[model samples]
Target: MGRLSGKVAVVTGASSGMGSEIVKLYAKEGASVVAVARRQNRLEELAASLADAEGKVEIFPGDISDKAVNEAMIDFAVEQFGKFDILVNNAGIMDDMAGVDAFSDEKLLKVFSVNVYGPFYATRKAVNTFKEQGNPGAIIHIASEGAYKTCAGAVYCASKAAVVALSRNTAYMYMHDGIRSNCIIAGGFKTEISTSMGMPNMEAYGKLKAVLGTAPEPGEPTEIAKACLFLASDDSAYVNGAELAVDGGWCAS
Candidate 1:
């Protein structure tokens, strides 16, 4: 049997990149998933692709930053799947690689709204659902290596730093209640976010990261998905409030 057999999970940003991969892996591992994102077609495509998987995938197209959407996502998961056991707060955006001096208030607010507020809103709903159902829950935050290092623009880093802090506090406050919260400090990956930032190809990106001295190459979405799987499964039952750096040693140097 798969590690997450019989579990129910909700993954944000499920339309693409790491989020899409996570949805696929979760279903493969025997978990019913509610895949949440803003793109209806993409979500539908994902759901269709997993039609023969070991579990189910239900799509929810909406913005994770909206409080109502967050609430509804949890509701959809529980109402559709019988229960919600895991939440992957994976929807996030990046700001132009501009310093604080050149950063506009709009840019700062937008990044924080998606990266920080979205997780907060969803986490609130998930925690409350676990409370109402009297069940243990796992909350996974897809943070960036930028949260711990200064390799990117200020707004994005600060926003993710807030995510790290929030995850830690959630774990501390809820461990006794059987709720677990953790952050994946992921390194550079060839996701839409990187392409949006105008980053070079993955090989070029790896070369750039190599300047930091013997770091691993840029990671794949599937790599991070696997790490998330570990955290979401009973394998991580004793892990809480931990920052798992699946960043290919970017934070090591």
Candidate 2:
């Protein structure tokens, strides 16, 4: 049997990058998946790809930073799949490079809204559902290496650090309920987020390869997806309040 057989999972930011991979992997492992994201078209495409898989997949599109959206996500999961087993709070954002003084309040709030409040709201909803359903479930937050290491700017790094602490404390608080919480500290990946942040187009991609002694190869979302699967599945029955680093050894260097 697959690792997630007889399970149902909800993954946020399900349209692309790590979130999309988590959604796909969970379904492949035999979990009925509720894919949540703001991009309805992308979510629909992902859902279609998983349609013929061993597990079921459904798509819900909305801005996770909104509390109403978060509540609807949980409601949709129950309405479609009957129960919830796992929640991957993976939606987030980064700001353009700016000094603390230079950063705009609007930008800071936007980042926090999606990165911090989004997960917080989603977790609250998920925990409530888990309690009412009387099912032991897992919640995994996709934090960044920034959470533990020094990184650019203040907002993104600080927000992620908060997420790390949130997961740890929540794990301890809900252990008796058989609900587990964890965070994945990921390294830099060549995702749309990076592209939007002006990482390198084809020309600069080559120049960077020449200068930085070759940029560290980006970590695949599937690798992180497997980690999420381990945590969500009974394989991690004893694992809780743990921060798993999927940083491709960036912390070592």
Candidate 3:
């Protein structure tokens, strides 16, 4: 039997990168996944591909920064699959490089709204559902190495740090309720988000490549997805409030 056999999972930011991989992995492990993202066309394409692979996948397109959308996503998952077992808060944004004093308030707020508040809203809805059902559920947040290192701007780093803290506290507060919370402190993953943000310089990218060996090799979305699967499945029954780093040893150096 697959690790996630018979479970229902919800993955935000499911249109691409780590979120897309998480949805694919969950389905491969036999979970029915509700794939949430703002890109409807991409989500539909993902759903179709998963279906072709004999996996159950559903699409729910919306901005996770919106509370109503978050609630709707949970509701959609439950309505389609009867219950929700895993909630992956993977939707996030990174700001352009700027010193604290040079950062624009507009960019800072937008980054926080998506990176911090988006996960918070989703977690709130998921907690309510898990509480009502009284079943064991797992919440996984895709935080960044920025939470621990100073590579990213202040706003992005602070937002991710908040997620880590929130996950730790949630794990402690809801252990009795059979709800487990964990965060993945990822680093230098080659995703659209990274390319879109535009690194400070080619030197910075080259430095990361030298340390990690390549942009896309070590931190593939599929690798992160596997870790998330382990946490979501009964295989990790004892794991909670843990920060799993899928950074290809970048943090080590």
* Candidate 3 off by > 4 Å: 195-218
Model 1 error, position 103 (Å): 0.6
Q: Please provide, for model 1 over 19-76, each residue's C-alpha lDDT reduced to its tens digit, 9 standing for 90 to 100.
A: 9999999999999999999999999999999999999999999988788999999999
lDDT of 3 by residue, 68-144 (tens): 99999999999998999899999988776565765778877888888888898889889999999888899999998
Q: Which residue pairs in candidate 2 have backbone atoms (N, alpha carbon, C) closer than 3 angstroms, thus clashing?
A: none
Query: Which ranges of candidate 2 are over 4 A from the true structure?
Result: 195-215
Error of 1 at 135 (Å): 0.6
Q: Per model, state how many residue pairs clash.
A: 0, 0, 0
lDDT, candidate 3, at 219: 57
Ranking by TM-score: 1, 3, 2
- Write down the TM-score for model 2: 0.91
